[model samples]
Target: MNYFIFGGSGFIGTHLVNLLKEKYPDGNIYNLDIRENNHDGKSKYINCDVKQPINLNIVVDQNDIIFNFAAVHTTPGHPNHEYFETNIYGAENVTAFAEKFGIKKILFTSSIAPYGASEEMKSEETLPTPNTPYGISKLVAEKIHMIWQAKKDTERQLTIVRPGVVFGKGENGNFTRLYWGIKKHRFFYPGRKDTIKASIYVKELVNFMLYRIEMDRSDVEIYNCTYEPAFTIEEISDAMMKATDMKRTIYKIPGGVLKFAAGIIGALGGKSFGIHPDRVKKLMISTNISGKKLKESDYQFQYSFEEALKDWYNDNDNLYLE
Candidate 1:
């Protein structure tokens, strides 16, 4: 089987590439990314921009499966236009390329952020009320895929995966920030420590994608790729504290106080604080998604949160200490 992956150098993409190599040892795999990956020499890497129209006919064939994982994911500092250009325009370019080459099976990696900040459990049926440009772009991209799928000649199998916060090795930004907080032994708990956060292990998410690829049904499928059991911030912090043998001081700052401070920081341009207003809002909001669909599909997680954290801690001990 020939597998073509866009954004193969990213955090989730790297893990997906590794899993594909292990699962299909003799199969041909091609990675299309802006930067070349420095991993094992098993897969072919092609540097290309998904935002621009490019002829991938040589690399992508009719029988191959195309996975679009490229996007400008949620970043507090990123401009709104960046998200639209990369997530929306990039998705359109890739889908058009796939249609032109007769590639039928395409998997799009979307986000639960499209559901917005919800207190209720989010499922596949939830109405997408995207809050940020990142979320709006992703949701819009998925809609574009649906439009292509509706065309008569475009007999494509589209699988849209709305995954929760995905964490694993090589993860930067949000995961790195939390890891550093834990490693420094100064982890602070804002509001209540028991704030729930939904997440998926990278391996599990990859497996889900592979499963969808193997079972190619005619219907357009959408699934939430997340762990069955949701986790709380307090639980994650406690596990990290136990794993590192570190005693971190926990602070229970009132939510109102934090909001007020955030407003003040926002009004002042946030340059002096080095923290964005979006980050402050995210910290207070809770995200809990239901992975019932994934579980019902007989997908099982290989590693628990504790196991993932332990591996992460051991690998980045030096970096965190510094």
Candidate 2:
């Protein structure tokens, strides 16, 4: 059976592709993405964009699985239309491709953004109140996938995972920024220490994905992908400090003071001064999510937050030492 991965060049996709290669070395792997492969040349790379109808003359097998991870996810980085253009249209195109090939199984990596900036711990059953364009787009994409699954309910399999901030090797996002912050001794608490930042290590994230794929469930199963009893910013920072034993003075600045400085910098056409207005605003919002269904499942959490940090830290000292 072949594996088709959309956005396989991205952070999560790259790691997922690695896992696939190790597990199914002989299986045909196809990566359809706008970017180049982030791994050694092992899989078939197709320069395809999902914003439009995909024209793949590939030898798609009946048992092949499709993983749709394509989307514009950067909140402060993307224009409003870009999210819809990539996420909404990409969903339609991917589902169409799956239908075209009669592929019955699909796993989608959605975000906890759909739950909005809520401080309350939410589960899969929680009603979504997505305020951002990115969140709205993902919520709509979920429905698009659901509609596809509904059409062939008996035969098809669909699994959806809504993960929080996923971090690990090759991830140059939030955790990377945090690493830099701590290393440079510039990391400071953003007004609130208790802000819940629900997150998971990328390796652990993919492990859960594989768990769902191997499960006997069929047709419409959605689970939030986060460590239950999420960590506060202070807690996360402390874990990092202990993991690396880095000596850095950390303190909290008044929210109003930082917000005011951010406004001036933002108005001056500056993205940020390590204090973007948008980033600062996002700092206080909590992502206290509950992976209730996952907790109730037979799958166990193999990697603790501390273990993840230590693994990531030792994986590359260059990232921290630099």
Candidate 3:
């Protein structure tokens, strides 16, 4: 088997690549990314930008299964245009290549961000109301995949996965920011501390993707990839504080006060605050998503939030803390 994974240099991508190599030792895996991956010789890394169309025929054959995981992702203070260009354009390019080569299966790694922040748990059936440009772009990309799948012949299959916040080694997103901040004794909780944040560990998400691909269903499917259990902001903060042995204060400022301060900081060109406005919004709002469909599909979480956090801390102990 030959597997092509875009964004293989990223946190989730690297973990997925490692898993694939171990699971299919005899198979060949090709990584397409803008930067070269630092993995061992088991996988081949190709430097390619997904935003631009590439002649994938040289690398990808009809027998190959392509996983489109490339994106600008969610970043604080990033321009909206960058997200659209990379995410939307990248999806278009990947689908174009897949259709041209008649690839049997193409798995798109999308985000739970498309469902947006909601006090109520969002399920697969919920209509998407994307709040951020990153989310909007991801939602649009999913639509593109659906459109292509509908128009394609009977040979191709498209699976769309809207995963919650994915965390693992080398991840520098909201998870890493909170983890390292707490580890370095710079932790702070904004607004209410009990907001539940939907998230999934990288290993579990990859496992689900591989499982679905093995099933080889013909219909286009969308699944919300997340853990059975959810974590509250307070719980995560407490866990990190305990793990790092930090005694730093956890402030519980009123939500309105924080929002006002954020508005002022935004007006001041984000110079007043060290963190970006988007990050602030994430901390304040609830992005909880449901994993009922994944659970109903008989997928179980391999690791608990506590276990994953411990692994993260142990692996990154020397690099960030020392």
Candidate 4:
């Protein structure tokens, strides 16, 4: 079967494509994205903008798997409307394309943002109380995909995955920034040391996705993707330090004080001060999500907090600025 992957050039998508290639060396995988795939450069690339209608003259069987990872997800990074514009339209267009082609098998990579900035570890059953535009848009997009599946539940296969902060090689997101912080000796704990930041390694996440899709179960499956017993901010910091063998004096600053100071610095220095107040606030909050559901499943986790960190460190030096 062929694979049509939207946003395949992105951090997670690239890893997913690579893993898929490993499993099916001869699989016809198409990477559709605005950007090019710099990770493997093996998958057939197509210029696709999910915000617009995905009406390309493409040919694939009805059973070809479609993976949707298209969205504008970074918070405090994009304008409020950008989130809705990209996410909503992307969902509409992708689902529209799927319906048109009668593609029964589809997988969507949603976000844990729908759970909002909660201190409690939320399950898949947790009633989403989304606060941010990113969160709200994603929750809505989940509905959009579900609607498509509703048209033909007995035959359609739709798997929705809400993953927390995912990190690995080529990922220039939170974990990369954290690694940069420690490397530059600017890493510091905001507020308390116990704030849980639910996260997962990219490879493990890809494996989990494949495992679930291959399962002969329900037609529509929704689950939260994260490592169980999520790591605290301090624990992550310690593990990261040990992984790269880069230890420095990291001080725990109170949340309020750090936010205030960062706000002023960010205002004066403009974008030069990457440490914005909103970012500081995020660090203080807890995203302690439970992977209890995933754990209960037959899918086994190959990486732990320490092991994931070590694997990433040894995997590449892209984020490791000397």
The 10-residue segment with the lowest total lDDT in model 4: 313-322
Task: Tell me the lDDT of candidate 2.
Answer: 0.85
Clashing pairs for predicted structure model 3, backbone only: none
Query: Once superposed on the true structure, which residue ranges of model 4 sit more than 4 Å away at CA?
Result: 38-40, 270-273, 317-322
Clashes of each: 0, 0, 0, 0
Candidate 3 minimal-lDDT segment of 10 residues: 270-279
C-alpha TM-score for every candidate: 0.88, 0.95, 0.88, 0.95
For residues 1-322, could you state the per-residue lDDT of candidate 1 as single tens digits?
A: 7888888888888888888889898888888889898357867888879889867546557778888999988667688999999988888998888778877888999888899886788889889898889999999999988877767433668899998778767776565666676665434566777677888767678887898887756558889887767778887667767766667767777766766776787788864443455665676677888888877876666677777666666666723411
Candidate 4 C-alpha lDDT tens digits along 1-322? 8888998888888888889888998988898899987455559888999999887766768878889998998879899999999899999999999888888878999999998887877999899999999999999999999999999988888899988789888887788778777777666788788989889889999998888776655388887888887888888888888888876778888888888888888878855436888988999899979888887888889988788887887777624611
After superposing candidate 2, which stretches have Cα over 4 Å from the reference?
A: 265-274, 318-322
How displaced is residue 205 in candidate 4, in Å?
0.7
Q: What overall lDDT, based on C-alpha atoms, would model 1 receive against the true structure?
A: 0.77
**Model 4 lDDT, residue 71, Cα:** 90
Runs of candidate 3 with Cα error greater than 4 angstroms are: 57-59, 242-249, 256-274, 317-322
Q: What count of clashes does model 2 give?
A: 0
lDDT of 3 by residue, 211-241 (tens): 8887756778899887655678887778666
